[model samples]
Target: MKANKAAVLTVAEKCKNILASNWQCHLSTIKADAKGSKGEIYTSKVKYIVKRGKPYVWVPESDAHNVNAIIDERGSLAITTPFPGPLAHLLKSVQKLPSRIALTGDVVLLKEKKAQLATEKLEALILSEQKAVNELSYTVRGVLSSTNPVFTSRSENLQGLTDGGENYNIYKFDLRSCTYLSGTGGTHEIDLGELQTSKADSLAPYSAMLIDGINQSESRRRALVLFCFTYLNARVKDAYILSLDRKGTDVLGKVPNPTSNEQFQWKEFRFTFKEEAPDVEALCCQLVEMEEEAIKKVSSYSGLG
Candidate 1:
């Protein structure tokens, strides 16, 4: 595997290992634009349990709304916890290293249950694998500089060292260092330096047009799905455009029921435009027409009209 690919996979496996041992994690759902600007972050506490060696997350019913919004909006999830002793020692050994890193993951919202029922059942069957549950696979990236001070301050407070009980530290991660990836298997290392200077329109003409069109639309997510269905001819779930360049647009989402097991896995779809869209309005019109055609095709196939 390539270096980037290896890095991503390592992060995913290590995260699973950590969760399996600790069983408790902090989950944060974030909504941000392709440009990495202007977004909201919501956090919830959740339990991670290992079943049949696979990790499954259990969220309280009260937190379901936040989690579902993440899936519907094609937002990102940041799963974090204070570094365990072993992990913290490893990180501390590296000089000039980031205080924190954020990993990108795919979140599948499992069936919901009442808080009391979930708690009781989980307590009883803690060692067994449940039939259906929420889960994610994540790729990580370092969040430099800005994170260190806050983590340091939180650590001092947590250990009661500011008042000098002992010279102890327990770092805490904040949501600001959120790392959002495509969620599809492919991994791309985001150069934070470049993000500071690059404009959204720096992408290819068609790529730029599509992103801008959807973003400007009254219903951005709806427009994105219609465009994919019409142009790529694929039914996608939890879809989001990751990046666009002169060559094509990199999309991330799940194909509904692609496997025999009925489990959805994130996949990347790349689309190249035959001709660049002239402008945002033209792109929107094109998408609307595609949606209409899609509806007609469904109507014809189902013999409903």
Candidate 2:
């Protein structure tokens, strides 16, 4: 029989180890100042390196000045330490002592509380980044689908129908350096550099048109569904995000049945500046052709009626 394998250490432990051996925690302290303005007094030397799964703060109790300063700042004994070096040397040291060894007063409690809060925050950041990515995936799927159904939740497969007007500002590019990434600012690692969303202060109204292409042979109301696709660009028309549009339609194609071949014939419309005439002209021409075909379909339906 094969031998049993050891259970892996939890994600928190892994993250802790990563944080301990590498990331430096910056602790700020407010102190009374002579100039009447509040001054922050911090230590450059009180840094700690992660040593063998343990936080090794170098501001030892042996140093009277550092020790007193730590005590004075927190009103309890707390030493500040940033990650210094590797941890292999302190493996035996960690196993022998309690998880933490505090020589000072209420410092241990504060440190422990901080550690707990940090862990919870890290988990929250993970959730936030996951949410952003999940939303992005849905947006991509919306662009690819034959009909874009406005979904209620970011993850739910359910779709909803909406008038084309309310859909413009739904999918937005939030342009701010919100600090919850990596282990710091917001943890969304979407580093879309250089091509950031425009900060232009212009009053241009976005247009939306819903076209239910005429083919009334199918008896079901949901059977005939037309999807709207919007190509978005922050800088110029040539540049495109993978999915820069909201799922603005609620037409889920036939399911399970192999024979249902419902095709969506779309009438495209676009807006562009007159200065960029060449690209704008091409887009307009395409729209005209698409509109002509849509008109022909409408005329045929009129003739049948």
lDDT of 2 by residue, 1-305 (tens): 11112222222322332332222233333344434324454433233323222333323333332333334434221221111111112222222110111111111212555544434443453354335434543323322232222211211111111122221111011222211122112222222242122111110000000111111122112222211112221111111011001111112122222344453221212222212212212322333443454445545657952
lDDT of 1 at 159: 24
Alpha-carbon shift of residue 281 in model 1 (angstroms): 3.1
Give candidate 2 regions above 4 Å deviation. Answer: 1-14, 23-27, 32-45, 49-54, 60-184, 187-305
After superposition on all CA atoms, what RMSD does each candidate show versus the true structure? 22.1, 24.0
lDDT tens digits, residue span 126-209, model 1: 322211111111100011111232232221222221233332111112112224232333343444443333333211212322
The prediction achieving the highest TM-score against the true structure is 1
List where candidate 1 sits over 4 angstroms from the true fold: 1-235, 244-248, 256-260
What local lDDT does model 2 show for residue 276? 21
TM-score of each: 0.28, 0.19
